[model samples]
Target: MTITKKQITFSQAINDAIQTAMAIDKSVICYGLGVTDPNGIFGSTIGLEEKFGSQRVFDIPASENAVTGVAIGAALDGVRPVVVHQRSDFSLLTLDQMINNAAKWRYMFNGIHSVPITNRLIVGRGWGQGPTHSQNLQALFSHIPGLKVIMPSTTYDVKGLLLSSVFDDDPVIFLEHRWLYNQVGLVPEGDYRIPIGKAKIINKGEDITVVGMSYMTIEALNLIAVLSENKISCELIDLRSIKPIDSKCIIDSVKKTGNLLVLDTACKFGSVASEIITLVVEECFSYLKQSPRRITLPDFPVPTSPALTSNFYPQDLKIMEVISEMLSKKINHQKQERPPISMHDIPGDWFKGPF
Candidate 1:
């Protein structure tokens, strides 16, 4: 089936999703820090207030917990609040409402009440963001029950998942990687909803099953060419929705390939990577030709220095080494072209600021 498409950046797709949702449902209100500011939360929330008016699209105070409580209250009263936190670290302050109230309102009331809210949390590493600002805490949110945790990688998935999260009755944690804002791709025009808890198989192959989450998906995609050159057919799966992982898709792929390599944006310990590995081990241990492996940051805080961070995060060279060991095949790393950027911190030359 052919999809109606237009070339747009990841951030534009997010803006389009919010605009489309608010236009369709008057009850859907977007308000958070920098919503009304000039940057418009890295341009995703731009022009929303002007088009939707102050009552529907406005700004909130710096109090994360208080703003979250207000959003939850509004959601309980039939409002679908889209709250945006500039950084995922800021969201730590609102866990009381997120974990206890927003996530549990529907179940706590025995389906009598539904808190349909979407919290957009931006997470990434770059430009000396340091330990606190650059945290991938999706696992923390995913551990909680009654919440939908989504980490979309593509422009198409981001918009579709955001729309789905906005409409769903349960509270949703929408995590966006800052580096992906400028990445462009063909996205459907409007009103498309990719179902929650479904993983997308990006590339089909036989040698190994490689799963990546958030920005790590992009990283994995970059290695496909080199892997292909070495006759390593990789089946790439993007774990878009973290909370309710698509176990069937992963298990089937692993059963076919008899190998699994997971790449996670979060730390190594007790991460989404670990969770997927455990699922495969429990469901399809007999199908494995070798032990499953994962590539993730060390179980420690992210360093601020570029020199430290360059090696701190999982490098493509390291990934190739692991794949070589996993499949007992060699990958020609010299043939792999490095990313076109002056520094490792910035995603690309198009990147402009600290937002």
Candidate 2:
């Protein structure tokens, strides 16, 4: 097992994934708004058009529905099209094409056709982008049966998952959190494909498990470090794919720790966290020592003000506070489960306060 290192931003990792996939498969094509040439927004697709040439990597007009329709048609005709929407909110404009067309094509055609297309969406709540641009709509596409929804939190996962998405037979909605573009992580030097439905446990611990996706995974890791300094250990699970969720990983962790906490940038209701909690309760209720808790953005549209936006979204501090409370409760419950022992059985100064 050899390790190779390269310093690349999150956005560059995505660009690498697209480039590698296209190099591997000639059928793979990239297109969408700002994905081409001079001054591409945020530069995620920078240099792609030049390297792949206009025929393979071209730009589309400001019509998401039309672009999506074209991608789906291409997929049906045996071409793998990777379409990008400027923002996650823009995906709403193509709901008809996605929900009715891309999602139902194989089923409607009785397996005679497959939509091997990837729709890349940039999502986040920042820079006063406000209500229109800050929405995290991965949950919406995850609801559709035939669509695969992937939200990678790290550069490695982004690279591997994006490669896998381009080759998958079903249509995929890849939601890239805009705010994570600059965050750095180590990625393998060569091409690799991470299994679509598997989850990765970034940290291991016995006390509790924190499950998150995209930027929320970064927040979970940050909270884990903070809690460790306080002598509390936590496991972090990154659910890279939302649609085909890794329930086995989630349930196994909950069983081992007997406690669960989900951190999601999306709203609390009808979100990925809600579905995960429901799955854990249904599958591992006997193993759970306490009820699962979730830290999520408030169930409302994001605000424009920076101060208000910070308050609206979930943060590391909020995650740390919730974990502390859960740990305290767990300690109390353990005390009740065990029998009391004599003073001689206890450690010295056990009853002393901060001594």
Candidate 3:
């Protein structure tokens, strides 16, 4: 396993992960909607079919449930299938297959059999994706037993986690935020793996514990500089894995900081954010200095208009405001920074959409 480093976008890292996995394993297969398209699902699947052949990397009809069922069957028969859904909302069509069968096959068989399937569900907010097209369902999937949910925010983690998911002997819900596809970072060359069920402390501070998932992690990171300047030290935790969440890391952080703030991409009600707050309250209630707080989208369908979408999606400024209130400090909006309201519908100016 030779290791070198180079800058790459989040989506390229994903493509590299799948390419590496398929290159090393004969049984690893990749298939899903728009997989073989020229655009290659935002270039994450480009050149895969040509490199590995259509037998292993092919397109499927838009029957998500049936396709997922077939993939689960293949996994049980010793094939590692990586199924990609263009939108996380599209995954709703396959819930019965995912929750009932794929997630329980190993347990139902007393651990003798396993479903080595990886479902890559794309999720995000942007460009009038609206309610139906842009839904963050990490919490919904994390509720199922025997299923591992992963949401990798950075380029490095995405590659490592995807590789791990593909090779794991159980079902893995690997979600990627569409906005993160263009995020560039230093990714190690060659194959490597980040263990499932682990959280990473991206920024360390003694004031507050901020746990974020997927794109929310990026938002949390952006606040570190402003928060620190205001004498508010923030300990930022990127929850790389949603289910089998890193309880020890979160508990330890809250014990030290005594304040908790969770930023989840999902809705406010019954979200992964709620689960994290509950865990902190249960494990470190006495250690907390203030009540745990979570910043999430309101419990309503996402609006399509740019004006509404701007307020719908929580960003760094919102996190800053929440942190200020939690710490009893006034927010200096003049010192805070954010993408212009004009670009609120997209992640950044660089975002040219295929949506």
Q: Please write out the lDDT profile of model 3 over residues 312-333, one tens digit for every residue.
A: 8888888988898899998565
Pairs that collide in candidate 2 are none
Determine which window of 10 residues in candidate 2 has minimal summed lDDT.
346-355
Query: What does candidate 3 score on TM?
Result: 0.97
| Per-residue lDDT of 268 in model 2 | 81
Off by over 4 Å in 3: 333-341
Q: Per-prediction RMSD in angstroms?
A: 1.4, 10.7, 1.3
Off by over 4 Å in 2: 1-4, 329-355
Computed on alpha carbons, the lDDT of every model, listed in order, comes to 0.92, 0.83, 0.92
Task: Quote model 1's TM-score.
Answer: 0.97
TM-score of 2: 0.90
Query: 43-92 in candidate 1: lDDT tens per residue?
Result: 99999999999999999878999989898999989999999998999999
